[model samples]
Target: MKMKCILCAAGALAMCTATAFANPAKESEKTEFNRHWFMQLQGGASYTLGEGSFGKLVSPAAALSAGYQFSPVWGLRFGLSGWQSKGAWVSPENVYQYKYLQGNVEATLDLANLFGRFNPVRTVNPYLFAGVGVNGAFDNDEANALNDKGYTLGNIWSGSKAFVAGRLGAGVNFRLSDCVLLGVEVNTNMLSDKYNSKKAGNLDWQFNALAGLTFRFGKNHKKPQPAAVVAAPVQTTPPAEKPRTPAVQEAAPVAAEKPAVAEKPAPLREDIFFRIGSAQVRDAEKAKIAALAEYLKANPDANVEVTGYADAVTGSNAFNLKISRQRAESVAAALKAAGIAAGRIRVNGKGDTVQPFPGVEKNRVSICIAK
Candidate 1:
């Protein structure tokens, strides 16, 4: 029966692995190995049920477990447990009490977040585990026949030594924080029948309910930043000088009418500039704002557009838009204070709709003027 159980467990594991590989959607999930390692401490009560030539015994036990999660989806646990129960045999006086101490190690696979249809916060995870280890037992004085019928008993009734054990369990994990997790689980350990010979060599079963806190370790758990893109520089060639025109020399030396003069185009100017989410202007920009005010005074015909922007970092499009508009209004107010006509200044906020730089901080704001 134990061999058959082992075979079935192996088959299930194979099927799970195959299914995981077959589904593309499952494969696309970011299995961030962030919580690769952890430790858990647990204490709980358990009921042991068993039957043998000696009798049947049901007992209560306590357990502690510590484990490491290989990923968000897989973990391995090692545990120690102890329990005591009562039993009866042929002779009415054959009643006795049994006690056991054991240890187990098992590998677990998370199923809830993996197989469940709905997961909002994505913090709750459930898993199933199965593995084999070892167990040791030491019977109580009564069961050891140390004082049988009020007299010293012989060694014919000693408890069995160490024996092989196997376990299967399920558990749930809740992420309480970035580095901490809370877990609750239930498991059953099957100790080989021969471990307690005095109890007719029947299989020993232990059930445990445990809760623990796990602490994750390592640098891989840190949040990742997006990669940056760099732009290549443009190349240009030098201009060649033109040969003197002979037609100009042959033409009558017309009075060199005052050399036709050319006027330089005006430099770009901003009506206003200020920070996002705040009305304060940056100190470095004060000189630029003064220069803009002087230029606007010289060219009264030019109209200014004070535009404001907010990055997508804040997470609310509507709120960002409102804030951006307020910022633009603030800048327009500043321009009005600088003597620019209310009618010559126009204000608008684009929020994140007109991002000039991809994932860059400098593209968050702007101010423009047109003639």
Candidate 2:
């Protein structure tokens, strides 16, 4: 029942975290591996299995680790864990303390970033790690003294002993800030039987429970802003009044009236913005197309040119050119749907070669000019 309660609490925490940080603005972020290095320090207690009671074998432990995240889901770290360890003997019933240290290179897999959407602001992250290294045990003064008294402590060594060790662990890190995290982990290490100054004829196990802080040093992925367009404001013309002929002029011989000159309409321009990586016209932008169509119909002599562009940060030159053409086609389709004749509309794709806007996101846009 206690285990079930813990599981339930964990599930609740995950749900709350996901709901609270469901930011749509993070969708455009692209991961950059160069900015994901981190360092961690932890302190806790360790328990080694032997012939004594469980409480007697507990000792203090601490670790320091530095790692780099190659991707959102994978990382590699080198760490050192050390402090005091306890060992025991069976026949004489003795528990002896020793100083120990382990250095290992571990590979870490972040399950949260792997399975769920990657969010740099995510509150809870869980990961697993495995490693192999060497463990050194030394300073067994209590056991050495007992051995001097002729008490049989099997395979006693006065000097430090080294053994090959393997480790497996799982941990959860809670984000405390943009650059810091609080974490907890538990792991078991397997070492040769000789590491404990005993001949158990099998591998020995050491378990550690730790909690600490991790400092993340690199930058997170930068999310691009939504595309935007700057358009010339529409100008309205006031009504023109008709001229009245002079009644007195009727008596005189009618002079040939000069022909009135036709006035040219002002040029109209508009812009349509798109989300990154997409060429579809949004519902809100449909009104711009309609307005342009009306302007075109009012001045039948006018023709429109539509040009589309893509941002430079997103894709290859060829890919950008293709998508930019698609964007222009999308706008041309919207214009045709608004009853503008296809023959009067011209479309062009500039890709990233011609950036009309200063911001990268603003380049993902299509501009329309009617003249």
Give the number of colliding residue pairs in candidate 1. Answer: 0
TM-score of each: 0.48, 0.56
lDDT of 1: 0.58
RMSD of each: 9.9, 14.5
Model 1 over residues 166-261: C-alpha lDDT tens digits? 888766666676557787666777765444333444575655666777665542232122343233333344444445545654667644445434
Best candidate, TM-score-wise? 2
Candidate 1 colliding pairs: none
Error of 2 at 165 (Å): 0.9
Poorest 10 consecutive residues by lDDT, candidate 1: 219-228
Residue clash pairs of candidate 2: none
lDDT of each: 0.58, 0.80
Which residue runs of candidate 1 sit more than 4 Å off their true CA positions?
1-35, 51-64, 82-101, 117-120, 146-160, 218-228, 234-371
The TM-score of candidate 1 is 0.48
Q: Least accurate stretch of 10 residues (summed lDDT) in model 2?
A: 1-10
Quote the positional error of residue 300 for candidate 2 in Å. 39
